[model samples]
Target: MEAFLAYTLVVAALCSYANSQLVPAIVTFGDSTVDVGNNDYLQTVFKANHPPYGQDFSNQEPTGRFCNGKLATDITAETLGFTTYAPAYLSPQASGKNLLVGANFASAGSGYDDSTAALSHVIPLSQQLQYFKEYQTKLASVAGSENASSIIKETLYLIGAGNSDFLQNYYINPFLNKHYTVDEYSSYLISIFSNFVKSLYGLGARRIGATSLAPTGCLPLARTIFGQHERGCVSSFNTDAQQFNKKINAAASQLQNQLPGLKIVIFDIFKPIYDLVANPKKYGFVEATKGCCGTGTVETTFVLCNQKSGTCSNATDLHHSKEASDHVSLKQFDVLRYQQAGRSRFLNDTDKAVNSHRLLNISKIPRRRNGYEHQENNSKFLQDGTMNIN
Candidate 1:
């Protein structure tokens, strides 16, 4: 599996370097919306640290991840050929050996603000970048400085964030509120992120992919908690998402112009996910409104999702263990607390759809040199962790 994953990474890197697709070594930043498990390291209570959260994952432990399965980062990594998970950079066991493999710096419940916007628990964008630096330094130390520098220069840097900034801080956050208006906030975030991207380039990141925020209004947590008893999603939230995405797209254009020779790209997570929600038929997804967990009651983010809790469906009643170390089999309910709450009736306007009116042309990107060429072309772009200093 590891070798297969590694091979996939090679291919994915080739494709991503093309600038039209995702690449290897996904370096993430942002909130629980995309956090892997940084919250597990922290003492904060705002986390998705329970079973059924990772029901689809191998270990099946909660581990503080904040998604039904893997988030967009995991899916992106899988496509790129990461043999297994992109290791958590902060994980003590990592010891920096996995630096070339890829790392996740995202924390659960985190946002653009120092304090969490909605859940009152999360790492801010600044901290996330700070951790990323630590990981890079550790890698430099382990890989004999020279090799580590080479690796960071060649590796693909992926960022998926900012929704928490808008939704939690600007829109619906209770404790930590927004200081700027939606337009001002979006500009502020993109501006900071623009500088942050330049910083990465300064630190030897030549390839980067920044994902725009998805439709927060359609997210289960947003729809339910901020609904004021309404079953459907809030429209204003989606509007914020659209505006934020437009800003990101614009910023990506500007950054690309500035970073010469570097392959910088933007992932349209908004369009893909929105399409899935709007026209489930286009994608193979059956449900998008709420997840298939809890008694259809908690939605897993706010409550436990356990089949043992009597909310699971009749199909696929298999058991798996909690921790990966112990291989003892447990009931399906014991691990994945997934429960089909039936098809969601609450949805955005089917008549007013983004995908229906839009035709996204497949953009082509230049594929970087494969591993062999990467080793050969170490001086031109992949030497001593130096970029944009050119």
Candidate 2:
């Protein structure tokens, strides 16, 4: 009996050691939903460079993130056992150590088409990819080709951009972008975006788990704009997202064939989102329409949503801040399809119910606190006292 117990303990130790060795570092690309802070490098107005953006973040300063708390990349990285995301590709603060973990190249308001739409202060899809290339070179310098490939192999390449293309082309900018109606547009986007996947595969990205667009109509921004403040989703935009996913599924199928030892996976966020809204008890959410901070024509993502100078300060308080319009509204295209299309979908205002006891149960050191920073200082330290956010 004693020997058997000892053998079991030995087996457990091996499992732990093997699990530790397999943890991989991811390098992310795409738009604001996953953008750690790349917009900080650009001069455009599409900046989220303020307090509230990251107020709830582990660091507690707008790291140029576009969510009340963690970005999709943050949650996904955490789920995959990564220590934490590497800084934005443009952050001068990033070091060799940081880059090896992962780097976010997403920018607010970016999309698949190079010339799809025009946003005053957003990164174009092509430019975001350029930054990705730069990150690859930098990683290569630090970890060498083999080590870099190892990191890339373990990383989950999440691409959450697309709706911005529609916003820039179909909605706000009346240029009739993409040359298709909503239904046709989704198909066109899928075709155009396939090349992007191909490009990443060529760059040594082996494992890709893309976030399929969610219900676009359900975004706060769409609700505000589509029906003059009516609640619920923008069916047209939502349909567009559905169509986009169908294409993504098809494209991933083709890309899988072309690449060797490569995998393309989809994070199915659409049906889940709709189901969450339709049946809040299952997901522990209520009030899916209004944003926590406030609402308006632009909803709660742009200037009004800032944790600093916006009407009501929530994302941050007693921290550095900015003025209205100073913070780039990530609320635009990111609101729902992006999962926010606000892209930061997993989190919702329902979490802040004043009297409702209902809450979404979770695991982690939440990246946000009145003053808290989120990260696995070391992956091995997970579940240790230091990792508890509050």
Candidate 3:
């Protein structure tokens, strides 16, 4: 018993040491999935800082996050041991120590393609990068040169964009459809993504995680516009999204090879969201077709999901379609585990801590399917720290 106790103490010390060595900060960029009210400061109609939108968030006050509650990034910051939320880079609240913890430059309706953002008067990717440069200068003044450099190098960068490019620009705009086929358009976006990652690396960002496009064809807006005749998801659009995801995955590999001493991981949000939509009953979701807000059919942005819109008792039902409602079924805890697992994998090797990083671990990372889906092997989806780090 004494020997066992001694071994346990040693293990505890090692664990604590590892926790202490975690990335010092988190910086985010992207569209609505990670946007925490940067649009509120902008003049675009894509804003979401109103009642009912934050009915479920802390203090039940809308702070510009697109969702009714905390965004995935908000939860991610807390999981990383951050006591305070990272304020929007454009907000007055984003000053002093908040800049140290990190800042969010994401804008709703923004995407890899500038035209998409321009259509809605949102900040473009190029402009967001400029803000990041400005952030570096501010950070250096506050934390001093060396401390700011350390913060930039050791920070976890989360980026999620590209959805608006397809949903708002490519699919709806006849001009783009006339100029480029879906395959050609995807390649064009990948090129932009490649440049973005390279630019971030040049700015001293070492650890980066970029999210792939979600199943947009499954969104309520898509269904309303393209699938109204069939009254279902637009299969062609979903197919395009899958193709884009595949191209981005390849791009990530290429970026890792080209940029030395840089770590980039592409998080696969498509599969988990697709699974929820495909098998809603397996995930305890009853209404998979519509969101809990307004009509849940075509509601998005300021026009829909507003204070006057009818909200469901449970926000988890905020999927965009009956068949696609599974997209929003992803629990906050599930996403947190996936991110933690990715961080653990990348940070596992202390010797190469500053030199190398790992991508997502596909084998052990489990999706948040319903009880029925895991009935056969309850242990498979368990959130234990045993997830394989590849």
Best by TM-score: 3
lDDT of 1 at 191: 57
Q: How far off is model 1, as Cα RMSD?
A: 12.6
lDDT of 3 at 196: 76
Candidate 1 segments whose C-alpha is farther than 4 A from its true place: 1-24, 117-121, 173-179, 228-230, 295-390
User: Residue-wise lDDT of candidate 2 within 1-390, one digit each (tens)?
Assistant: 111111122222222323434346656666656667777888776666764566666667766776556654554455345676668777885668788877777776677655542454566666667777777778889999888877766565657667666654467654443333566556555655565666666666665656567566765556666756567677877777777766776666665555565555543356655664466454334444544454434534443365434534433211112221111222211222332122124323211211112223333222321112222333322222121112
What candidate 2 gets wrong by more than 4 Å, as runs, is 1-23, 116-118, 177-179, 296-304, 307-390
In candidate 3, how many Å is residue 342 off? 9.0
Per-model TM against the reference: 0.68, 0.69, 0.78
lDDT of 1 by residue, 111-198 (tens): 5444443355556665666777788887878777888777777676766567666654556543323333567556656656666676
Error of 2 at 20 (Å): 9.8
Best to worst by lDDT, what's the order?
3, 2, 1
At residue 149, give the lDDT of candidate 2.
76
Worst lDDT run of 10 residues, candidate 2, spans: 1-10
lDDT of 3 by residue, 203-302 (tens): 8886777767767777656666677656576888888988887888777776666666666666445555666567767767775556567666555443
- Name the regions of candidate 3 deviating beyond 4 angstroms: 1-20, 298-303, 316-390
